[model samples]
Target: MARAILLRQLTLGPRSRLQLERKLRDRNVPMEVAAALLDRFEDVGLVDDAEFARMWVRGRGEAKSLGRSALRRELNEKGITGDLAEEALEELTPDAEEESARRLLARRVRPFDRTDPAARDKELRRLVGLLARKGHSPGSAFRLAAQVIDADSGDNVLEQRPY
Candidate 1:
């Protein structure tokens, strides 16, 4: 029965071992039964935390434009931890993160012209908040926001300031 439940869950989507175990516990499956079933699943490659972490990181990073810190928090929430989580996060380079941040800012700030100080400042604050919530450092967010604004305006008018 435990095996059936686990297989049914996996048929829907991949699940971390911890998630699977929690599901089994929620269903009142005995601890020993859950352990044995999970061990079997692991042996058969049906429950692989590392691979789950990797896929999670890739999918979330691309879909959400999240940085390493955000990715780490997500993995932790999914019960991925320690070296496995770190290994998955390694797939996203700092350059890639920076580029994603720039793209996000560009798309969001396109409406506000950089020539207008009031509008630009308001837009910058909003963009920086977006980036910060996505786990980007304030400094990097400010620098990238300024770069995008300057490039769009065709003038290096926006100076990089500490956020």
Candidate 2:
């Protein structure tokens, strides 16, 4: 029954060893049995945390535009940590993260004209807050939001603040 449970979980989707262990535990599988089952799955190349983290980062980045900070937290929650999480996070380069942030802001932020200083400031704050909640650093969020707003207003101002 334990083996059947593990197989059924795996067939549904890839799982980290820890996730599988939790599943077995929830089903009242014995500790020793769960450990042995997980060990065998690892030995047979089924329960790989590294691969799981990689795929997770890739999928989430494409689908959700999650920043590295958010990805790290998610990986840690899934029992993918240390080298595996860091290695997977390395795929999202600084440039890629900035691009993702820009893309996210583009979708949500409307263009603000240079004539309306009050409205532009409000919009900037809103965009910065949105990016901050999504795990982007404050400096990058503010700068990126400013750049997008500037570009939209035809000023083409470059924000060169050190992040």
Candidate 3:
């Protein structure tokens, strides 16, 4: 019974043990049975939260251009915890976010015109909002968009302030 439930859930996608446990309990599976089944699944390599977290972060981050901060939040919400999440996040560092952002900008930067105030305002807001939804901070998203805009236009729309 426990295996049936677990397999059903996994057929949808990988799930952390905690998330599975919650769902199993909600379905009225015995706690002891659920725990034993989870242990068995782990011992046999059928369930691995660490691997799940890693793959989840990589796929979502790359596809959606999410930053580390956003990815971490997603991992936590999905029932991944502690060192597993941290290590997976660390492994994703070293330009993954920048690469994702570059890919996103490459696909969507053509229509924005930095010279027109109203058009620039609308474009900047749209870009910032889109990037923010993907987990980039407002400041980081703005800076990255500015980089793309300047590179394409030969003039910096967001000139750096004197430090």
Candidate 4:
């Protein structure tokens, strides 16, 4: 029954060992039975934390444009931590993260109006808050927001045109 439960859960989606253990425990599977079954699954390559982490990071990062911090928090919640999580996060390099942040900000920020200090300050705060809510550091959020705003300062018509 436990094996069938594990297999069914795997069929639904990839899961970390800890996730499976929690499910088994909920279903009243003995701890020893759960451990033995998990061991067999791992040995047979049916359960791999590293691979699950990689897939989760890639899928979530691409789909949501999430930062490393957000991804790490999600992984940690799912019982993926330490080296496994870091290895997965490494796939999202600093350059890629910056680009993603810039793209997101570019799409969101309004054209700058230096003529109005109140409006400009409000927009800057909004952009920085956007990135912060998405799990970026305050410094990184400000930098990226500023970079995108500066890049779209309308000095160059062809380059700054938004699609």
Better of 3 and 4 by lDDT: 4
33-131 per-residue lDDT for model 3 (tens digits): 999999999999888999999998889888787888889999999888789999888877646676677668656775655678888777767777778
Question: What stretches of model 2 exceed 4 Å from their correct place?
Answer: 111-114, 153-163
Q: List the residue pairs that clash in candidate 2.
A: none
**Top-lDDT candidate index:** 4
Give the candidate order by descending lDDT: 4, 2, 1, 3
lDDT of each: 0.83, 0.84, 0.79, 0.85
- Give all TM-scores, in the order shown: 0.88, 0.88, 0.83, 0.85
Q: Candidate 3, which segments miss by more than 4 Å at Cα? A: 110-113, 153-163
Model 3, C-alpha of 5: deviation from truth (Å): 1.2
Expressed as tens digits, the lDDT of each residue in 47-135 for candidate 1 is: 99999999998888877889888999989988999999999999988877886776676567656655689987887788788899998
Q: Which ranges of candidate 1 are over 4 A from the true structure? A: 153-163
Between candidates 2 and 3, which one is better according to lDDT?
2
Cα lDDT tens digits for candidate 4, 1-163: 9999999999999999999999999999999999999999999999999999999988887667788999999999989999999999999887677667776776787775767878777888999999888888899899776666566363432244334
Q: What TM value does model 1 have?
A: 0.88
Q: Candidate 3: RMSD over Cα atoms?
A: 5.0
Quote the lDDT for 118 in model 1.
Answer: 92
